[model samples]
Target: MKKITIQEIAKLSGVSVSTVSRVINNSPSVSAAKRKKIQAIIDEHNYTPSVFARGMVNKQTKNIGVILPDISNPYFISLITQIQKFALDYMFSTILFNTMLAEPNNKNSKHPLTEEDYLKIILEKQVDGLLILGGEIDKEVVSKDYINALNQLNREIPVVVIGSKIPELNCLFIERNLKKGITTLVSHLTALDHKNIGFIGGEAGVKITSYRLESFKAAMASYNHSVNEDWIVLSDYYTADGYAAMTKLLENNTTLPTALVAINDNVAIGAIRAINDAKLSCPEDIAIVSCDQFMNGDYQTPRLTSMDQHNEYLGKMALLQLISAINGQVEPMIINHNPELIIRESCGSKL
Candidate 1:
């Protein structure tokens, strides 16, 4: 059987090979009608593009490398899905790496992978660029060694950090004001006439934990409500850790708050489960709020009232920044997204 190529397909369709290639790659430069025509002809002829030939002509593997701390977490998974949607539209493919930064013994470690392992894979593949989503970048301050390693990598390939530490090396950065998300969640709880509020945050020392905890405290204090230290549950950024933290808060013997604010949707959902196990209903016994709303949150019994971080938008923006950096059109840039509160049944009805 003869394997038809792009040239043969283009010739049969009476169009330029570039047009056929654009249609195969889904490049926006091709007209919709032309793309449909090319795709039909390719389908009829059973033509396939040579991956080697495409790479040789474009000087691109059409591959992006994503290094994330945890792929199982809903927040990260949702982001990956959105990135795929946009990347596919542009005819790009992705390679994923779970850079297990969370330690095995650590209850909070969402990633059981390592930085060195991912770095090695990225280098070996010679990917077009890197999209780093977690681990050291979430730190308030990155270590010298980590910075040095990233700097060395950036010398060869463009790197983009999403919701991670800003490296000294010029790299595109996409992050949310995580503190704002916490504040918005907490503020909504406070407005519900809940004077006594509890906070469940990530591990005490990680960058995300510190930023969110401080914001929670500030927001509570601003409303003239003193946070009982016992009411605050600090643990790792996982559902099990959130459950443990909430259990600790429940056992603390402090006056239970009327509402609760959780670090992220995972923790919030865990806390919700714990509340149910305790025979309590949210907003009836205790109201609840959390950040990083995913589709799963919508189907919950009460549906979560969450802070929308515009994750899909972030994914698209990150790609734009990364491509520009790769083309040397601009230096590394930082883009900060503000958090917005989405009202739902979890938080008490507007008073």
Candidate 2:
């Protein structure tokens, strides 16, 4: 829809431009009688005031800077889509920076600018706030330089991280309940009469990998099952990484885990292919469960039985948190998002 000028709106509402501006900004100086009339005209016309004009009063550009590790990853894609949708509700725009550091297929490609480099750009752009997902902040031990950069940035603008909560910086954090998802998957496999379970994918040293692995072990121990160290493989987050890891497990050991929990859907698909290439069937041979669910999970050969981290909901909550921070409604804090188990053929649940 075309946006009409504020002057046109004021003229239509039979009020001065300053009166309309005051009404748009919710200035208490405007009388209720005029405020109600102007508001009704705004509602009827669906008029959205310009951010530049609003900035003069609120000192906000109304643009949010969204920084994520990779755009190629389905998880970030799903999450960012929701962020953009909700930002518009408050007349805010999102400026996305795809760092491309975690792109599975483009590992060999080189990018000159690091995440901090993008932070400088974001500052220059003068965004109202920052929403960061899965980058240096997701490391178990984030670099001092990165932490310094983030702290400096936070001093200027509110920063929200959709990952781990760093003690060094007082940035607000929104994290997934990694233990619940992992424990729930293990419980499902155990209930299905599967005793031996293994894990695949996810590189070590990353905060997410550590969280999932810890939860996987704890979950298995909870059910009186021992974790097989040999079957547990730590690799990158990619289809090829999963294929290679699974193949290594299949080749080296005749004794295998009855069930496997993958790091993500990409790894699960690769593991399934490796299982198939070895002349084995999913569920019938080695039931698979994925930690992360993607958009195309249902279309896989055997639909993925995975943990739905509710990325969309996470994204929405992140935006809301950022909005709250922008409005000075919150301080540095953490919100834990709950993940759900989505069952499908891959886990032998359908069979």
Candidate 3:
């Protein structure tokens, strides 16, 4: 099939090519009547502009490349959905690159991804902007090499970091206040007469995990209850890992804590299963509190008491901020959102 061109549109509309060009480019010189006639012809033919041509005029490829550490996690999954929705509304396209950062691959492999891999993707894909999620965003302890690589990327393109932060980068930052969320959980437990509260946290390596762990300690300390190292189990954010961590904490000799604060709803659900396996009832033998406030948490046998981080809202805000940065309308600023606690039957409070 022959491609539709401005010449064809101008001929069909009974106008000059210059008139069609003015209409297409939204130039002020084009009369409304002529612009409508050209646009109607173009619309009837369903003429799609080539990205290359658009780039020549706008200096943008209209593509936002998203690099996420792990795409499978529910949190990230929800984030992606919201981001895609906003991108579509703005008439922008997105390309995804999943690093699968937590998949336990050999770190000593020959093809380890350096900063160059990221830079190459931007150049090769011709993306106008970039959104970096997860691993790099949640780097609590970043190496000098990691910092240098990120700095290189920042100098080149419009970048945004979602649900995390990086130091000294001119990139928009959006973060859910995990510490406040954890504190809400602790307060719930404290209200339930839970003095001996145990915590199940994420692995020690990542920045988000470390921040949550430290927050948990601080919140617990505020209530005059020190977290027992034996009671605190650190595991990767997986259901099986969460179950195993709960198992380990139970296997210890000390008495089980009256309540458990899980890192996220995923971990808390696993802990719930572990609790049931041990023949103890939730909120009767022990109460369960988690984060993320996933929709499914409400449908559980006993609804979960969790923290709602408003992830979808966060995703929308991040996309809006990214667009602002991409258009050079605003300098990158940190967006710190606080989480709210949703009380349910799992914590045994009717209120």
Top-lDDT candidate index: 2
* Model 1 misplaced regions, further than 4 Å: 1-51, 101-113, 164-167, 333-336
Roughly what TM-score does model 3 have, to 2 decimal places? 0.83
- Top TM-score hit: 2
User: Each model's C-alpha lDDT?
Assistant: 0.78, 0.88, 0.77
What lDDT does model 1 reach?
Answer: 0.78
Clashing pairs in 3: 140-207
- For candidate 3, write residues 14-56 as lDDT tens digits: 9887777777657899888888877888888888767567666
Best of the two (1, 3) by TM-score: 3
Estimated TM-score for each candidate: 0.82, 0.89, 0.83
Over 198-297, each residue of candidate 2 has an lDDT whose tens digit, in order, gives: 9999989898899999999999999999988998999988999999989999998889888999999999999999999999999799999999998899
lDDT of 1 by residue, 1-351 (tens): 888877788888889988888888778998778788888988887777776688779787778888887788777887888887887776678898876644443457565544654676697898888888777767676767677778788787888888654537566677667787877777677667787888885876577778778888899899998988888888876777767877777777557888888878888778878878878788798888886776677788788898888888888888877777766765656566877888888897752
